[model samples]
Target: MAQQPRYAQTPTTGGAPAALAPSASSSAATTSTKIGDRAFDKIEKTSAEFFAITYGALVRQMFIDHNERADIVNTQLDQMGERIGVRLIEEYAARSGAPPCRSPAQAADSVAKIGLKMFNPQRPSQWLQPPRSSGPVSSSTGAAIGDAANGSNGGAVYSISFDENPLNVFVELPDALRQTLWYSNVLCGVIRGGLQQVGFVTLVWYVRDVLRGDDVNEIRIQFQGKERETFKVDMQK
Candidate 1:
């Protein structure tokens, strides 16, 4: 029989037991009836163990398909996330009734306030201040990922922290493959793809991961600019 995947057994904060603090305004009652809440309610609740196993299997398959190549796996994971994000944004916008974000800070706030709150245990307190602009920014898939942490459009960076990562519930990474596998990199792609639908171009990636043993799990995101399409036209030579 295959050895069952090992889970980090330590009791940690986060997961489904956490409650969302309702707004204090009188309209709070009305807000409670909003689409996001309704949608969240309709979601099928499942054990983290199950989610972990299922997600793990998917990742394992990808690794196998790619001959356990980490870089390719990471890229594939991000693409998958971006596709999900593209769809998720439409769903979120329609359900939450959130207005279009005007700036990076506003976008980050909505991502934390509505996006994370409804789905995960993260709260607004977990959001870090947007990174300040100083120098040239780095590219996403190149040496820039290791260079200045600034973004493209006016160099604004935003981030959120997660105390408990459901995906990591039953994960035990082999020492040799730890750096090779970015277990949650899909989130970076998701954020990038989701915001792209709303007219924002961004570069998102994990600055930290609990599996890698960082203080609090963090994802650092940068706002690049608006995505544009180019077309070819026939002209007299």
Candidate 2:
């Protein structure tokens, strides 16, 4: 007997077979983009130049306060970003009306498409997988990069790449700070903190930074595990 096709065709009122509707993931992505655009339109505006310069000044002061200890300064920056992220995630939830992310991929999509877009507004972030062992994969910045290894013990790993970083505007790194400092390490902390707030314990770090003369800025994130909540009950005397 002859084999039949995998998907059976269904006829519509017009008598022609109906086309398949969009996939759920595709529809969800469209919805996320629309939500991000609407939220961006409603947020207060700020000058990018001003924001960059102010952040630069703050970083410089941190260098001064920490006696140019790059590691210490980096730690402090990450701490500051974590605090900001803790609050920003709440605002994002309230404004974007986005549903809770049920998986690492969904969380990554929300962060790259919605969260980052809300701040940058003009630039779009690219979610990328690392290169396979067979060959390197092309990235948004036109560089050959590989996909990150899957997180340990069934965790997930992915990268977000950016062609431009507003934080690096009007900023240059001296030779001394090149190797020791990650200028935008705060972004990694922000990702970690924001996801942590929603029950995800993630390990986030910068893999490539334009400030360090890389072709693009890439932040790698790995899902570690879910945050375990502990509550203490008091006994009345």
Candidate 3:
């Protein structure tokens, strides 16, 4: 018999997200192109399958085959994240004209309008900025964002929050509950793969949040504080 589809249904979970996301809305008055549950289901299944393959390979390549080495696996994941950063910059440049995203809202717009289109064609983007940035949250022109950055008191402190997670399609996976399942920082891989497909290599990709939860799907890439480096997305606003 042919194997069952991945999303025939969600596997039992500790529990599903408190609320599933609402269907997307369109501002254009004439016509709206939207992907419904069926599309989401397909993405969900593909995500789960990919996670399985990547996680298993990671374990074998890192632990059983050589011996558990945390650093090795982590470096791999981060390299992947940087690759994604590079590819995303290219896409943003093409569609959004490469701005450093003056505000959190703009960042969300970049992810939605550019990132989602290139990565998760089936899903829309939803961005939530983490409090404020330790690195001045102002326009490249150096205009202060005012009181909004008032919360910037954190002072170069590390602030952790979610970024654009296309893999949320795997939210609460089945069977894998309890131990659940995670190919930690696998987003790094996706980012790397997507970027390498094009051409860009500044920083290496990496994953910080692990098997955390669907609530905070965080991922990032860095090259030794090179985030300050000039790039297309960093172009003047």
Candidate 4:
């Protein structure tokens, strides 16, 4: 039998229920939404069909380059995404002028509300929904980030589900590759790399894939810990 995954606990303050303060939460959401909208309007636009076709070509070439080894192609895609993400963060910071995230919850929210809007060609309203945090919700705040399954470890976990994925726009997987290839795995690496640039260490993976016959595409994100100071020094060496 497959083992179930553990999740984070709900966060709380001073014995109160785990939830964001109503007014504060609303204000923050509004501000972030506006920032996202502005950033999206300012960024350069591209033809969706062209982008999709180009990406498809890249993936197909990768398969051929790797002798049709899906696993190797997946890893290379992630690595490529990481490099892109590292550079993309610089553009994101400059263009969005958004504030830095203080918690895993905040990061998840920003990615859904801001990052996706800025980069994705789709209109903000078209996004199926914002990222969903696991665990209980407060009536006022709706569903917000909760504590980690191991609260003692001081981490959190959340998920982002999409009804539509732009990359999968013109993609159809063959039966032979369906079970082995994660068609959109680069996204997982992009998120992981982007967060790492901001000091958060995270573990990201696909929980559900639309290509795999899932109703909605979902990616799970687990906060591990902050990057150590030494990490920067080591990278410079």
Candidate 5:
């Protein structure tokens, strides 16, 4: 699980829930629908453990089911990623120079950087070092996966989590971000869509609860199928 970013801050009055005060707005009904607490409570209730475990398990199950046809699953996932990569390549070409993607690691790093930048501009992601591809990033046999002297590294898989923990979606938002996971997941869908467009057609995509019942806290992805061992990207140190 990734930690949430620093930018997400909830409004506070001396670290306490301030009493509901009438908004300065002169409209009577305007202040009446100012249900700040209600939204937060709903978000809190949504991110509960039940939602996380159930959602996580459902995604995992979907992957296994897709994997029933190992050969097709493998091709399907890579094609999906590739399809996204193709469209992304054109986008990248239009926006920036296109670097040669020669391995799975490279592809992951490229996707992460370009995807994040084209999607979110506020807090961009920094790729971790060691440039190791682990945990099913792709199911390709020839993919480069780092391994220990006595153990095996998981295949190359991209594990994405929010930068902040328990983002308060229902609380008074700071305008940096709105108070809704539903709004945030649009980024996720764009990413998922890009991947599918690139040809990782068999992936299981869904949002996960990071803050118990809040759903505002986290979004997650697990490749239900496979990816192509095509590129080696430099994870920005």
Candidate 6:
């Protein structure tokens, strides 16, 4: 029997983001109309079934390659993510041309709005991922909108809360490595690595995980410092 689609019955309350008009310089745009349109059009999403298996194999290989050291695996994953981030910024700018974010709150909002839409656009509204930076609040008395919440001191810190991770789709950690493994920790590195290119140095990490039986998955990003000089050099490179 054929399996049901994971997001078939999923609600789509949030409106789709308006496509960023590609500028003349973005050769990638010439190849694909929109950042997500290619994936949306050609590939039949596998309900993440094959993704889980392939990702599981990768983790297993990493374990053998590293001699079963969880710390080394985690660090390796982060470093790999960082390299991806360094390149991702260039692609992101080419596609979106999102201006330099002024504060941590703004950066978090952009990550939730633009980043998710580019990568995980097809997820259901049940995922509670916001369509825009100004998403709905969870409670009537809430102070913030969507998963992007500004901290008490304002721009110094913020959190982007969400329920699903594209990488962690249908993942189940074995009991032997449950406590030691941060299954999706590479994401933290991605955020840190990508943002650093844009001049914002940050501390990014997971606060909760569904793999750990948490109700939600959240990533907290804290402002560290900004380097305009090096940022320009990195962008030029």
Top model number, TM-score: 2
Q: What is the lDDT of residue 219 in candidate 1?
A: 76
lDDT tens digits, residues 115-214, model 5?
Answer: 4433232122222222242222211222222221111233334434344322223323222222222323334444555554433432323233333343
What candidate 6 gets wrong by more than 4 Å, as runs, is: 1-51, 122-155, 229-237
> Largest lDDT belongs to which candidate?
2
List runs of model 5 lying over 4 Å from the truth: 1-89, 100-103, 124-155, 164-183, 202-219, 223-237
lDDT of 2 by residue, 121-189 (tens): 433456677543222335743321233456555567777788888777777786677767888778888
Relative to the unseen true structure, what is the Cα RMSD of model 6? 10.5
Provide the global lDDT of candidate 6 against the true structure: 0.56
User: Order of all candidates by lDDT, from best down to worst?
Assistant: 2, 4, 1, 6, 3, 5
Candidate 3 per-residue C-alpha lDDT over 1-237 given as tens digits, one digit per residue, 9 for 90 to 100: 211112223355575433323336555221111212222233333344354444445544653432334455455555655566556555445444434544333333334344444344334322222235423221122221121122333311111234334344343333322132233554555444433333332232222332443433343322121123344343553
Candidate 1 vs 5: which has more lDDT:
1
**Candidate 1 vs candidate 6: which has greater lDDT?**
1
Candidate 6 accuracy as TM-score:
0.64
- For 106-195, candidate 6 gives per-residue lDDT tens digits of 666566555544545432122122222433334222233234443433435555566656666545666666667777777778888888
Superior by lDDT: candidate 4 or candidate 6 = 4
What are the RMSD figures for all models against the true structure? 9.7, 17.6, 10.8, 13.6, 17.3, 10.5
Model 2 ranges with Cα > 4 A deviation: 1-29, 131-149, 228-237
lDDT (tens digit, per residue) of candidate 1 on 1-237: 222224455455666542333333333232323533454554545555556667788888887788778789889999999998877776566556666666666666666666554554334335554345422222222221113245545556766666677677668776656666788788788888877877677888877676766556777778787554221111221
Q: What is the C-alpha lDDT of each candidate?
A: 0.62, 0.67, 0.37, 0.65, 0.35, 0.56
Question: What is candidate 2's CA lDDT for residue 26?
Answer: 33
List residue ranges in candidate 3 displaced over 4 A: 1-25, 28-66, 95-109, 121-210, 213-216, 219-237
